[model samples]
Target: MRIIGLLLLTGSLTMGLAACGGGDEQSTAKQEKAVETSTEAKAGVEEFTITAKNWNFSSDKEIVVKKGEKVKLNLVNKEGLHTIKNDELGIDLTADKPAEFMADKTGEYVLKCSTVCGATQDHEGMEISLKVVD
Candidate 1:
């Protein structure tokens, strides 16, 4: 019984010592690096607000963006779940929270709601034209 008690006391002390070591310094350094990287990546983005209702998009109904510019497309849903997809940019954004995409090409791309909803916005076929100018 005395040997068992000694072993338990030693094990507890070893674990306590390990927990008090400087592992938190490494964790804090990594977190700071990640925040810096994210800030730099979003430094020069041109932001826009897009509102999605039951079957349509409001506030900048059609997008006219400049090519080679980083666009931050912010989407707000007020009615239901909506999806905006652009085939050229390979974007399929869901309207749950805010979202963003880059405008890098100079041409016309078809934008539309990919959500299958009720009999509004032309029966779930609401569309928008995105024209990127050089």
Candidate 2:
């Protein structure tokens, strides 16, 4: 019984010593790095806003943006879950939250809502086309 008690005490001491040996320094360093990364990410982007409602976009035309520019396509949904997708011209946006995209190239592109919430005949309550210029 004494041997078992001694073994348990030793085990607890060993574990406590190992835990207090500055092993958390590595984790602290990683957390600092993550904070730095988050700051950097917020610094590297530009912003823009768009509103969607009823059977039309707020602007009856596509937004013209310059190439190599960071665009935060802030879409405001006044009704349903709207989405925007343009894989070829590099535009994948969702209307649930403000969407961001970069105009990497100079060309005329089509941007459309990926979420088909209603009728498909006349594309009511959906938006399409965004022209990107050099």
Candidate 3:
């Protein structure tokens, strides 16, 4: 009779522990998902669109953004195919794809056309500036 009572107690304890462990695992998963959602919401992004034409960019000559902010740059080719690149900021903008990065450094970055589309002077003069401020 004593052995029977001990066995019942042990079985009940084991079942209780299993239930608690499963609940804890589910709770942990929910907490992790909430943290991920909060982090994504905290990350702010800034987007800018620049249009390129035959000889120059039709949009603004300079783009300004805050340091440490995420930047999304879109290049729209209105007339011809062109490519712009900046080694310092690791920016490569083309008519096919866009560029995205964090503006961590505060300075002036010059983005120039890397593709030869027309005359030397036109390609040489085609450029834009990106300014990151505090």
Best by TM-score: 3
List, in order, the clash count of every candidate structure.
0, 0, 0
Candidate 2 colliding pairs: none
| Number of the candidate with higher TM-score, 2 or 3 | 3
**What TM-scores do the predictions have?**
0.57, 0.54, 0.64
lDDT score at residue 14, model 2, on the 0-100 scale: 100
Candidate 3's residue-wise lDDT over 1-134, tens digit each? 99999999999999999877866458545644543454466557676667778888755345899999998776766667888899888889875576888999999888898889899998899988889999
lDDT of 1 by residue, 1-134 (tens): 99999999999999999888877466545644543455467778755555667767765445787888776565555567677777778667664444466787789877678787567656455766667899
lDDT of 2 by residue, 9-31 (tens): 99999999988887546654554
Q: Would you list the clashing residue pairs of candidate 1?
A: none
Q: What is the TM-score of candidate 1?
A: 0.57
lDDT value for model 3: 0.77
Q: Which stretches of model 1 miss by more than 4 angstroms?
A: 1-43, 60-62, 97-99
Which scores greater on TM-score, model 1 or model 2? 1
Stretches of candidate 3 exceeding 4 Å from the true structure: 1-43, 60-62
Give each prediction's root-mean-square deviation over alpha carbons: 10.7, 12.2, 16.2
